[model samples]
Target chain A: MTSNLRFVFYPGCLVLQRMPQYELATKRLLAALGIGLQDMPQASCCGAPVVESFSDEWVYLAAYNLALAERLGLDVLTVCGSCTNSLKRARLALRDPEVREDVNRRLAALGLSVEGRAEVKHLLQVLMEHRAALKESVTAPLRLKVALTYPCQVFRPGDVAAFDDPLQPQSMHELVALTGAEIVETGVEHECCGSTLYTSNQPLALSAGRRKLEASRGADVLVDSCGNCHWLLERMQRAIWAGEPHKRLPVLFMPQLLGLALGLAPDELGVNSRVVALLGRDAHD
Target chain B: MIENCTHCGLCREVCPAEKLGGRTITSLLSGGDEYSAWLCCCCQLCQEVCPEGVDIHQVMMCERRREPAPDPHRRSFENVLRYGYAFPITEDINAMRSAHGLDPVELISAEQVRLLLHCL
Candidate 1:
């Protein structure tokens, strides 16, 4: 059956710059689940951390991206937690007539005006919405013990992002369970992965990430849904676990793990050799 | 909105920055300028836990705008102004995309970005 679900894929700046694997896996898995992703044309940043910190123009940048998706007549599917939060917050702020008027006046120059038409949903939210389809697509059941690092911005500040329990999120756990993986309780499951802090304070960022990795020693792998979390916890593991490679836990993006269960090839999902090796060992056992 | 803060310290209880010895939301509420607002991880936990509905993130943003932004934030702002993206997109990025069997992304034109962000 051809499902009618479609979205304008918003791969925020971090994903575009640093994580092709996550993007590739997201597209492959979502397609398998009958979700169509149309690329947002001429998409820019969602006015993530930097612009948000220093200027109210962050709303303008985020509104511009939303306007592009609105023009496409589709809701947005964001892969990054920061983008999810930024866009949602901007949408909420734009509800005020004064803010909307000011933003529309500025956006008029680029031939774009946000009518608050496009809704932004993170990849996790989209996946949860299609849980029935996801269950049918899984050809492989990954029985490995998985520790989850929930993306902070995705569900927090409940009034704005308002999807899951802001304090004790369960969507990721529920989604991972569908793949037949065992979810381990890592004490730091809801802790920040320190990606936002990395640019500001490297040592503190590494310390925060290291704490999570060390606390999840019992899990066979760590899974994250946000680009920033994956970047610091997975891509920067070498720096976080310097001189102690054995202490480094394997990390996978949520889609990569889902793609594995969907029977997609590891290479196609852009899963690294370490995770592939873990899968190999799981199979042999 | 800061006026609504009851100083109940619920935000600090869940703040990663406070745990890491950085005086964040609680300090800001108490008029403490010693806090480095840049230390925030932007997790939104503080705002989520605030009983008074204080928009802590907005408060932090206001504080951040008043100070000289950290170097990384400045660079990201400059990159956004120049490329319409937070990070510079070069030919190598497209080359990598091609290798991954993904279509190359066509970024917004610099002129168009300038017009859109002229108010900045």
Candidate 2:
């Protein structure tokens, strides 16, 4: 996509703290491509599904986040799926005259306000929109086959945040294609990786992950657009390998993979971390 | 919805919460498995990540909340207020924070907490 200066980048909770590489790579990648990701000085959690479960009022907490983006005078680009869905849904919901009034009043009490002005765009859309820039930026075309494992949270259902067909997602694949890496189109690509549940139920996490890996058949690696999927798959693989036939399919944040394709070194992009090892030590793997 | 469960348990295989508890969702749904709910971290990872799309976290949380309050975990903040301290103690949060030059910056006061609870 033709992007230039001035865009507010919403680094969801996972990206800001746990997955620093995602923020690092996104900031650099966007900068290299003439996209400016302005940070909100007073940003907090968007309050994902868990908080949303408790109360509809929790949604204003998210609207508060979008309001921060709106105050910045830029469209908000989020890298997390649930964050993307939550922000987009909150934006649409807050526009209701009644909800907007309620949200703004509650937030104003907290030094926040929901104006419902920021547009929500996921990183996937921006990357795909500027395919030509990404293509020209590739220092080395990665030739390994990688599965695009988009967990359900990352893919929004019809209506809010529904930019493409969630059932059969091809945006990440299309973006990967520009890097010259072979994309393994797998059915389980849309399956949930059990995300953070691995911390609670190890065996089920491993089983779910093994099912996904089994579906991939012979893919060289898996590229994830969400941090939770990347962490869950890698953690589950460890759980699975503890007893049975070890499956070591590597999972990567698509941004990290792009960094590698753009001639970034291993340690430079945090590829030396354990998860990156699953994708293999070399470009050919 | 409590007494209406089909004894045929699809929730066991499909539930991440049940898997962690080593029990079936059928049992949890039947007002049992309080121990598992006590162990729940409130991650909601189970509900959102379910292949079958069952709301396991809600089922577990409901079961947990009904029981006489259990010590799930946490020290400071409201986790201590509700769950008590169950999990192992790491270093004190303030110590680690100060070490990182990121000492705790309290946004709301204890009175605010009381006001919120009282308002509720």
Best-fitting candidate, scored by TM-score: 1
What fraction of the true interface does each of the listed models get right, in terms of native contacts kept?
0.79, 0.02
Colliding pairs, model 1: none
lDDT by residue (A10-101, candidate 2, tens digit) is 76645554555666667667766777776654444465443433334446557767877777678888887777877877888876999888
Q: How does residue B88 of candidate 1 score in lDDT?
A: 91
lDDT per residue for candidate 2 within B25-104, as digits (tens), equals 34564445434544343333444334455555446546544543322111211321221111222234335434433323
Q: Which candidate leads the pack in lDDT?
A: 1
In terms of DockQ, which candidate is strongest?
1
Relative to the real complex, the DockQ score for model 2 comes to 0.11
Query: Which ranges of candidate 2 are over 4 A from the true structure?
Result: A1-3, A199-201, A244-246, A273-285, B1-120
Write down the DockQ of candidate 1: 0.80
Q: Which stretch of 10 consecutive residues in model 2 chain B shows the poorest summed lDDT?
A: B80-89
Q: After superposition, how far is residue A110 of candidate 1 from its true place, in Å?
A: 1.4
Prediction 2 TM-score vs. true: 0.71
Q: Against the true structure, what is each candidate's TM-score?
A: 0.96, 0.71
